[model samples]
Target: MLEKTGVPTPEQVKRAAPTEDRLKKGPVAVVECFQSIPCDPCQYACNQGAIKEFVDINDVPIIDHEECNGCGICISQCPGLAIFVIDATYSEDKGLVKVPHEYTPLPEKGEVVTGLDMAGNEACDAEVVKVQSAKSLDRTPVVWLAVPHDCLMKVRGFRRKGGAE
Candidate 1:
Protein backbone atom coordinates (compact mmCIF):
# COMPACT_ATOMS: atom_id res chain seq x y z
CA MET A 1 0.00 0.00 0.00
CA LEU A 2 2.84 2.37 0.78
CA GLU A 3 4.51 1.70 -2.56
CA LYS A 4 1.28 2.20 -4.49
CA THR A 5 0.30 5.29 -2.52
CA GLY A 6 2.32 7.93 -0.77
CA VAL A 7 0.53 7.25 2.50
CA PRO A 8 1.97 4.58 4.75
CA THR A 9 0.09 1.57 5.98
CA PRO A 10 -1.00 1.04 9.59
CA GLU A 11 1.73 -1.56 10.01
CA GLN A 12 4.35 0.87 8.80
CA VAL A 13 3.09 3.49 11.21
CA LYS A 14 3.17 0.97 14.03
CA ARG A 15 6.82 0.24 13.30
CA ALA A 16 7.65 3.89 13.89
CA ALA A 17 5.36 4.42 16.85
CA PRO A 18 6.71 4.31 20.39
CA THR A 19 5.42 1.77 22.83
CA GLU A 20 2.23 2.43 24.82
CA ASP A 21 4.31 2.64 27.98
CA ARG A 22 6.47 5.29 26.32
CA LEU A 23 3.42 7.27 25.25
CA LYS A 24 2.10 7.36 28.79
CA LYS A 25 5.37 8.83 30.02
CA GLY A 26 5.10 12.15 28.20
CA PRO A 27 5.62 13.84 24.87
CA VAL A 28 7.97 12.10 22.39
CA ALA A 29 9.06 12.44 18.79
CA VAL A 30 7.26 10.22 16.28
CA VAL A 31 9.16 9.79 13.04
CA GLU A 32 6.74 8.59 10.36
CA CYS A 33 9.46 8.39 7.75
CA PHE A 34 8.84 5.05 6.09
CA GLN A 35 11.26 5.46 3.20
CA SER A 36 15.00 5.17 3.33
CA ILE A 37 16.00 8.25 1.39
CA PRO A 38 18.82 10.66 1.99
CA CYS A 39 17.75 12.48 5.13
CA ASP A 40 19.53 13.29 8.38
CA PRO A 41 18.23 16.66 9.51
CA CYS A 42 16.06 15.00 12.11
CA GLN A 43 19.09 13.50 13.81
CA TYR A 44 20.91 16.79 13.91
CA ALA A 45 17.81 18.62 15.07
CA CYS A 46 17.42 16.40 18.12
CA ASN A 47 19.39 17.98 20.94
CA GLN A 48 18.69 15.09 23.29
CA GLY A 49 20.53 12.62 21.05
CA ALA A 50 17.42 10.50 20.80
CA ILE A 51 17.57 10.16 17.04
CA LYS A 52 20.42 7.76 16.44
CA GLU A 53 23.28 8.82 14.19
CA PHE A 54 22.80 7.43 10.72
CA VAL A 55 25.49 5.09 9.45
CA ASP A 56 24.35 5.75 5.91
CA ILE A 57 22.46 8.88 4.90
CA ASN A 58 19.84 6.71 3.24
CA ASP A 59 19.00 4.82 6.41
CA VAL A 60 15.65 5.50 8.05
CA PRO A 61 15.87 7.32 11.37
CA ILE A 62 15.96 5.18 14.52
CA ILE A 63 14.66 7.03 17.53
CA ASP A 64 15.74 6.23 21.09
CA HIS A 65 12.47 6.86 22.87
CA GLU A 66 14.11 6.76 26.26
CA GLU A 67 16.31 9.74 25.44
CA CYS A 68 13.76 11.86 23.60
CA ASN A 69 12.24 14.65 25.65
CA GLY A 70 9.76 15.65 22.94
CA CYS A 71 11.00 19.24 22.83
CA GLY A 72 9.63 19.31 19.24
CA ILE A 73 12.80 20.96 17.98
CA CYS A 74 13.01 18.38 15.18
CA ILE A 75 9.46 18.98 13.91
CA SER A 76 10.28 21.85 11.54
CA GLN A 77 13.66 20.47 10.53
CA CYS A 78 12.13 17.57 8.61
CA PRO A 79 11.86 18.56 4.96
CA GLY A 80 9.39 15.72 4.38
CA LEU A 81 7.19 16.97 7.23
CA ALA A 82 7.20 13.52 8.74
CA ILE A 83 8.33 14.22 12.27
CA PHE A 84 5.69 14.93 14.93
CA VAL A 85 5.56 15.28 18.71
CA ILE A 86 2.77 13.51 20.55
CA ASP A 87 1.91 14.03 24.20
CA ALA A 88 -0.63 11.42 25.14
CA THR A 89 -0.36 12.38 28.77
CA TYR A 90 -1.53 15.91 28.22
CA SER A 91 -4.92 15.43 29.84
CA GLU A 92 -7.46 12.82 30.81
CA ASP A 93 -9.42 13.25 27.60
CA LYS A 94 -7.04 15.22 25.37
CA GLY A 95 -3.61 14.80 23.83
CA LEU A 96 -1.29 17.18 22.04
CA VAL A 97 0.13 16.62 18.59
CA LYS A 98 2.74 19.01 17.25
CA VAL A 99 2.96 19.06 13.47
CA PRO A 100 4.94 21.07 10.96
CA HIS A 101 3.04 23.70 9.00
CA GLU A 102 4.24 25.65 5.98
CA TYR A 103 0.94 26.92 4.63
CA THR A 104 -0.20 30.50 4.52
CA PRO A 105 -2.83 32.00 6.83
CA LEU A 106 -1.63 29.86 9.71
CA PRO A 107 -4.23 28.81 12.21
CA GLU A 108 -4.27 31.19 15.15
CA LYS A 109 -3.89 29.98 18.72
CA GLY A 110 -7.12 29.11 20.49
CA GLU A 111 -8.84 28.51 17.14
CA VAL A 112 -10.69 25.35 16.21
CA VAL A 113 -9.48 23.50 13.14
CA THR A 114 -10.43 20.39 11.21
CA GLY A 115 -7.91 17.74 12.02
CA LEU A 116 -6.76 15.58 9.12
CA ASP A 117 -5.47 12.05 9.15
CA MET A 118 -2.61 10.58 7.13
CA ALA A 119 -4.88 10.33 4.06
CA GLY A 120 -5.74 14.03 4.37
CA ASN A 121 -9.24 13.14 5.48
CA GLU A 122 -11.07 14.86 8.30
CA ALA A 123 -10.47 12.94 11.52
CA CYS A 124 -11.84 15.27 14.16
CA ASP A 125 -12.04 18.84 15.46
CA ALA A 126 -8.83 20.06 17.07
CA GLU A 127 -7.99 23.22 18.92
CA VAL A 128 -4.90 25.19 18.10
CA VAL A 129 -2.92 25.35 21.29
CA LYS A 130 0.15 27.17 20.02
CA VAL A 131 2.03 28.21 16.90
CA GLN A 132 5.81 28.37 16.81
CA SER A 133 7.04 30.42 13.85
CA ALA A 134 10.43 31.54 15.03
CA LYS A 135 12.97 32.34 12.34
CA SER A 136 15.23 29.61 13.63
CA LEU A 137 12.72 27.03 12.41
CA ASP A 138 13.50 28.03 8.84
CA ARG A 139 10.34 28.58 6.75
CA THR A 140 8.39 25.76 8.37
CA PRO A 141 6.33 26.60 11.43
CA VAL A 142 5.18 24.07 14.02
CA VAL A 143 1.56 24.01 15.11
CA TRP A 144 0.58 22.51 18.47
CA LEU A 145 -2.91 21.02 18.42
CA ALA A 146 -5.00 19.79 21.30
CA VAL A 147 -7.12 16.85 20.16
CA PRO A 148 -9.13 14.09 21.74
CA HIS A 149 -7.05 11.26 23.17
CA ASP A 150 -8.52 8.84 20.66
CA CYS A 151 -7.49 11.12 17.81
CA LEU A 152 -3.92 11.61 18.94
CA MET A 153 -2.52 9.24 16.34
CA LYS A 154 -5.30 9.85 13.81
CA VAL A 155 -4.79 13.61 13.57
CA ARG A 156 -1.46 14.40 12.00
CA GLY A 157 -2.38 17.57 10.03
CA PHE A 158 -5.19 20.07 10.08
CA ARG A 159 -7.22 22.47 7.91
CA ARG A 160 -8.42 25.81 9.11
CA LYS A 161 -12.13 26.18 9.81
CA GLY A 162 -13.98 26.66 6.48
CA GLY A 163 -10.65 26.33 4.70
CA ALA A 164 -9.84 24.26 1.64
CA GLU A 165 -9.80 20.48 2.03
Candidate 2:
Protein backbone atom coordinates (compact mmCIF):
# COMPACT_ATOMS: atom_id res chain seq x y z
CA MET A 1 0.00 0.00 0.00
CA LEU A 2 2.77 2.44 0.91
CA GLU A 3 4.88 1.83 -2.14
CA LYS A 4 1.88 1.98 -4.40
CA THR A 5 0.66 5.30 -3.11
CA GLY A 6 2.31 6.56 0.02
CA VAL A 7 5.92 6.52 -1.07
CA PRO A 8 7.28 8.88 -3.67
CA THR A 9 7.58 7.60 -7.22
CA PRO A 10 10.85 7.43 -9.13
CA GLU A 11 9.77 10.26 -11.39
CA GLN A 12 9.28 12.58 -8.44
CA VAL A 13 12.68 11.77 -7.01
CA LYS A 14 14.32 12.31 -10.35
CA ARG A 15 12.79 15.75 -10.72
CA ALA A 16 14.29 16.97 -7.45
CA ALA A 17 17.40 14.80 -7.48
CA PRO A 18 20.72 16.64 -7.39
CA THR A 19 23.12 16.30 -10.30
CA GLU A 20 26.00 13.83 -10.19
CA ASP A 21 28.53 16.65 -10.24
CA ARG A 22 26.87 18.32 -7.27
CA LEU A 23 26.90 15.05 -5.37
CA LYS A 24 30.57 14.53 -6.23
CA LYS A 25 31.67 17.96 -5.14
CA GLY A 26 31.17 17.25 -1.45
CA PRO A 27 28.52 16.54 1.11
CA VAL A 28 25.14 18.05 0.21
CA ALA A 29 21.89 18.13 2.10
CA VAL A 30 19.16 16.03 0.47
CA VAL A 31 15.94 17.26 1.96
CA GLU A 32 13.15 14.74 1.35
CA CYS A 33 10.59 16.99 2.94
CA PHE A 34 7.35 16.57 1.00
CA GLN A 35 4.80 17.47 3.62
CA SER A 36 3.91 20.82 5.07
CA ILE A 37 4.22 21.19 8.81
CA PRO A 38 4.99 23.92 11.30
CA CYS A 39 8.74 23.50 11.19
CA ASP A 40 11.68 25.84 10.65
CA PRO A 41 14.42 24.13 12.62
CA CYS A 42 16.22 23.10 9.46
CA GLN A 43 16.78 26.71 8.46
CA TYR A 44 17.99 27.73 11.89
CA ALA A 45 20.21 24.69 12.29
CA CYS A 46 22.27 25.51 9.23
CA ASN A 47 24.99 27.97 10.12
CA GLN A 48 25.62 28.57 6.44
CA GLY A 49 21.99 29.38 5.72
CA ALA A 50 21.87 26.67 3.10
CA ILE A 51 18.29 25.95 3.97
CA LYS A 52 15.97 28.90 3.41
CA GLU A 53 13.39 29.81 5.96
CA PHE A 54 9.73 29.39 5.07
CA VAL A 55 7.67 32.55 5.19
CA ASP A 56 4.88 30.37 6.43
CA ILE A 57 5.57 27.55 8.82
CA ASN A 58 3.55 25.20 6.62
CA ASP A 59 5.73 25.91 3.64
CA VAL A 60 8.23 23.24 2.82
CA PRO A 61 11.88 23.90 3.49
CA ILE A 62 13.91 25.14 0.54
CA ILE A 63 17.59 24.26 0.29
CA ASP A 64 20.15 25.88 -1.91
CA HIS A 65 22.04 22.68 -2.64
CA GLU A 66 24.92 24.67 -4.04
CA GLU A 67 25.41 26.53 -0.80
CA CYS A 68 25.26 23.38 1.28
CA ASN A 69 28.69 22.14 2.32
CA GLY A 70 27.04 18.99 3.70
CA CYS A 71 28.18 19.66 7.24
CA GLY A 72 25.12 17.61 8.37
CA ILE A 73 24.13 19.94 11.21
CA CYS A 74 20.60 19.95 9.88
CA ILE A 75 20.36 16.17 9.86
CA SER A 76 19.87 15.95 13.62
CA GLN A 77 18.08 19.29 13.80
CA CYS A 78 15.27 17.97 11.68
CA PRO A 79 12.73 16.41 13.98
CA GLY A 80 11.25 14.47 11.08
CA LEU A 81 14.63 12.97 10.14
CA ALA A 82 13.97 14.01 6.58
CA ILE A 83 17.47 15.24 5.82
CA PHE A 84 20.37 13.16 4.44
CA VAL A 85 23.96 14.07 3.63
CA ILE A 86 25.25 12.43 0.47
CA ASP A 87 28.96 12.44 -0.28
CA ALA A 88 29.56 10.94 -3.69
CA THR A 89 33.27 11.68 -3.53
CA TYR A 90 33.91 9.51 -0.51
CA SER A 91 35.88 7.11 -2.68
CA GLU A 92 36.40 6.07 -6.25
CA ASP A 93 33.96 3.21 -5.98
CA LYS A 94 32.06 4.11 -2.86
CA GLY A 95 29.76 6.89 -1.65
CA LEU A 96 28.96 7.99 1.87
CA VAL A 97 25.45 8.64 3.10
CA LYS A 98 24.72 10.19 6.49
CA VAL A 99 21.36 9.28 7.92
CA PRO A 100 19.64 9.92 11.24
CA HIS A 101 19.40 6.79 13.37
CA GLU A 102 17.20 6.88 16.47
CA TYR A 103 17.05 3.19 17.17
CA THR A 104 18.95 1.56 19.97
CA PRO A 105 22.11 -0.54 19.70
CA LEU A 106 23.53 1.88 17.19
CA PRO A 107 25.76 0.30 14.61
CA GLU A 108 29.43 0.93 15.21
CA LYS A 109 32.00 2.22 12.77
CA GLY A 110 33.29 -0.38 10.29
CA GLU A 111 30.28 -2.64 10.83
CA VAL A 112 28.68 -4.20 7.80
CA VAL A 113 24.94 -3.58 7.74
CA THR A 114 22.04 -3.76 5.37
CA GLY A 115 21.42 -0.45 3.64
CA LEU A 116 17.82 0.61 3.34
CA ASP A 117 16.12 2.70 0.69
CA MET A 118 13.62 5.53 1.10
CA ALA A 119 10.81 3.02 1.39
CA GLY A 120 12.65 1.20 4.15
CA ASN A 121 13.57 -1.72 1.89
CA GLU A 122 16.98 -3.36 1.88
CA ALA A 123 18.87 -1.89 -1.03
CA CYS A 124 22.38 -3.17 -0.44
CA ASP A 125 24.98 -4.24 2.09
CA ALA A 126 26.90 -1.23 3.31
CA GLU A 127 29.70 -0.62 5.78
CA VAL A 128 29.31 1.80 8.63
CA VAL A 129 31.97 4.34 7.86
CA LYS A 130 31.26 6.74 10.72
CA VAL A 131 28.92 7.20 13.63
CA GLN A 132 28.46 10.66 15.18
CA SER A 133 26.52 11.01 18.41
CA ALA A 134 27.69 14.29 19.86
CA LYS A 135 25.86 15.81 22.77
CA SER A 136 24.68 18.65 20.56
CA LEU A 137 22.84 16.05 18.49
CA ASP A 138 20.62 15.38 21.48
CA ARG A 139 20.58 11.57 21.17
CA THR A 140 20.02 11.49 17.43
CA PRO A 141 22.96 9.57 16.07
CA VAL A 142 24.09 10.19 12.53
CA VAL A 143 25.18 6.98 10.86
CA TRP A 144 27.40 7.21 7.83
CA LEU A 145 27.52 4.32 5.38
CA ALA A 146 30.00 3.51 2.67
CA VAL A 147 27.84 2.15 -0.11
CA PRO A 148 28.47 1.35 -3.74
CA HIS A 149 28.90 4.42 -5.91
CA ASP A 150 25.87 3.52 -7.94
CA CYS A 151 23.74 3.37 -4.82
CA LEU A 152 24.74 6.80 -3.60
CA MET A 153 21.30 8.23 -4.11
CA LYS A 154 19.41 5.01 -3.40
CA VAL A 155 20.80 4.15 0.02
CA ARG A 156 19.04 6.12 2.75
CA GLY A 157 19.48 4.28 6.07
CA PHE A 158 20.88 1.08 7.57
CA ARG A 159 19.88 -1.92 9.65
CA ARG A 160 22.00 -4.04 11.97
CA LYS A 161 23.34 -7.47 10.98
CA GLY A 162 20.77 -9.46 12.94
CA GLY A 163 17.82 -7.18 12.14
CA ALA A 164 16.51 -3.69 12.59
CA GLU A 165 16.63 -2.38 16.16
Q: Please tell me which predicted candidate would have the highest TM-score against the true structure.
A: 1
How high is the CA lDDT of each candidate model?
A: 0.91, 0.86
Residue 60 of model 2 has an lDDT of 90
Could you estimate the TM-score for every candidate?
0.97, 0.93
Query: How do the residues 18-127 of candidate 2 rate in per-residue lDDT, one tens digit apiece?
Result: 78778868889888877778888888899988888779988898888888999999999999898898898888889898999999888888999999887888999999
Candidate 1, residue 34: Cα displacement in angstroms equals 0.9
RMSD of each: 1.0, 1.7
RMSD of 2: 1.7
lDDT score of residue 82 within candidate 1: 92
| Candidate 2 Cα deviation (angstroms), residue 131 | 0.6
